[model samples]
Target: MSEPNVLRVEGLRVHYQTPAGPVKAVDGVSFAVRPGERFGLVGESGSGKSTIALSLLRMIKPPGRVEDGSVTLDGVELLELTDEEMRRVRLARISLVAQGAMNSLNPVKRIREQIALGLREHGAAREGRAFDTFLTELLERVGLRRGVGDMFPHELSGGMKQRVCIAMAISLEPQVIVADEPTSALDVVVQWQVIDTLRRVQSELGAAVIQIGHDMGLMAHSVERIGVMYAGKLVESAAVRDLFRAPLHPYTQLLIASLPSLDGKERLQGIAGSPPSLLNPPAGCPFHPRCPFVMDVCRTTMPPPREHRPGHFAACHLYETS
Candidate 1:
């Protein structure tokens, strides 16, 4: 059976106007999310992972327009919607579990009230007992007790806050969930717990999830497909198994090499050079300066995405079938 597309992004380019000039934060990126599938976007800081996530709901702030692209969720184009229309879609259709859950929650509001706010805004019946039952079940599903909902955000621990955030994101049963660094700023155990909750929720709701993180191990463990970004552009994207086995892009190879394994025998070595500044990125391949296998052609021409292997794509000239 053909997989259903839950979200599709095409030629997505987000640029921010700064005093230095226009900074290309997300440059000509394209990817898709299938129903019930987990798609991982892995990259270092300034690689535009968060920017692309924000652009999905048309949340890019002033001077950071989505420039040119189509962000369509289940046939509805988000970029063309008005502010009011977009707001409805933000939580109901596509919700973002922002990077910092501890700070994202309102300190003064009770968890139940905050969750209710999402329910009421999304037109879910607020006066019915069925909704109340569902809310209670949601807290439990996220590993939180019902009584925790009566507590304020500040009263909950970091892990509890993250769980509350997850509950809020899925409370509306959104078709697509953008989890941007959902595990950042937490202890290892908490991170694992949050990831586990997200995994279970995605499976239960049959919703597509776009997990954004810079850590390869976390991304590998949580996602079925991985997209590697460098200097605002997608360098490689493939099935998780295929990517870990044979990464096509040099940048991807470097990222995989840098992952510290649990065996305590593997040494991690990060990529040599730092990512280029977005304000004045390198001329051709943004990763050319850092790529160990840089070719003359890579230094002068931007390589277009090509099918390096069946079902795998990369933007490196060396991997281009053409």
Candidate 2:
């Protein structure tokens, strides 16, 4: 965590060309991930967390494009690379564990065949029994049985399917892993198992991880740092302990307050009003309409992100006054 940043993102903006004008999915968001560190992106649905993931890997398809930004991996500007160059970079250097395991895997292909895709593409594939031995080790690394190499997607449980995705993600030992909701839709036990599996493999490979999810509780103990986003903008970013202990932005505070308390003492509260429409957000801060501490400056001008405390950054008028 003390190492220099392995991946740096700055001034990122991703927009979708909808019929009702362009929807700003990501608006000038910036953050960085250090080697072998676990970073979390937590926000409500439609807050552009997933969009930032897509933009990082240069996967935003037609209709949605990374308008302006700088994504550099080890000092190489990702935005400047050619399509094929970026293609080579993926899996070999950067891999993704998609949110939906079933959707990410091919139902028609067996697990062994599917796992071979990255190895083969990256020129590390072995044939016959040698390949079987390699595949078995890969599956075992993610807490899967050796027999799982012959099973299809439907045969595995939700957690197992996700573990399979993790196995595939680490086959080539990439430098970074982007896990977009890797534990969603699973029971508590299964979620814990999958998260453990992810952490184990990440440790063995020594890869930096960017975990994107809506579960703040899950993120609290699983990561070192957290970035909070709202309505296409990063409202706050800080160390996980500091973020939970002293939330800087209003949205961050409300989000933490909304989580159910384990002691059953504090009432679980929901934030008033819904997230703004990205197609036509408010003039100043998009979160101003829902914020309780709104001010004249917040209503009229978009607050630039500033480091309020050491390594803690927030975009809000309250800090400016303090």
Candidate 3:
């Protein structure tokens, strides 16, 4: 959907303080998510994809902190909000379906109580028959039976637990849902089911979704647009089909090339080297060491992002301004 942006992140930067120095988790990453759109952030481990998700919800802890930038949701500045104000923003405006359902769910609490926690925090708590009907409709939307809510986490299967989390995330009808690897550790069939459930609820609510995952295959078909992150920066941004068909960044190209083709004819290609350490990244482009088309300029000069095609942007020495 080419609707107005529901969320906008500009010049975002997050760092983790360490004995050696700061680990630049997110460095000047910027993008916008439109209403009813599914946006994916794909990257290798430690590439700051989840960090960006947490930053959006103001969840950075003690050792880690947001150093700069702004996060605006529907024209309201999130970073400027007070703690109490931010609490209200969460669940009500932007909710998260954590990567691990076991970790997010309370073993002692019934599913209804856990979900009710969000509603209560957002001051939308319901009780008795009212809550039962709401819970039934919510769980049904995620393809679960209403009685599943009265059961404890231990009674549910892995897939059901995840579906419960999805129910919790959408229960408040948030404007944006941050799903960080929602389908992780699930079987293929269940993965598809969970994704379908998520897509259905998102469409029903017309809420934007930020899908963070390392599974390029799932992301290829799930999201409308994708942002490729490398060395704590977004190296490329484009529509899903455009990015996969014609990845501009060297890292992104290598990533796409590494995917196994369904025909089983194309040999999987791998990147030559590993990603650079953010603690002391290379002087110029972090990817120049692994880039096949590295130039003299790439060794000492960081390439500024440039738009190479309509609605596609990349940071690489290969692309010159038109």
**Which segments of candidate 2 are over 4 A away from where they belong?**
1-3
Pairs clashing within candidate 1: none
The candidate that achieves the highest lDDT relative to the unseen native structure: 3
Of the candidates numbered 1 and 3, which has the greater lDDT value? Answer: 3
List runs of model 3 lying over 4 Å from the truth. 1-3
lDDT per residue as tens, model 1, 1-322: 3436889999999999999899999999999989889999999999999999899978899998889989888988888888988888877889989989668788888888888888888777476677668879999989898899789988888989988998989888899999999989999988899999999998999989999999998987899999999989998999999999999898888888887778768666978878899999998899999888988998899999988689899998887655
Name the regions of candidate 1 deviating beyond 4 angstroms: 1-3, 128-131, 264-268
TM-score-wise, the better of 1 and 2 is 2
Q: What is the lDDT of residue 171 in candidate 3?
A: 88
Worst 10 residues of 3 by lDDT: 96-105
Q: After superposition, how far is residue 150 of candidate 3 from its true place, in Å?
A: 1.5
* Residue 218 in candidate 3, Cα distance off native in Å: 0.6
Q: Each candidate's lDDT (Cα)? A: 0.89, 0.90, 0.91
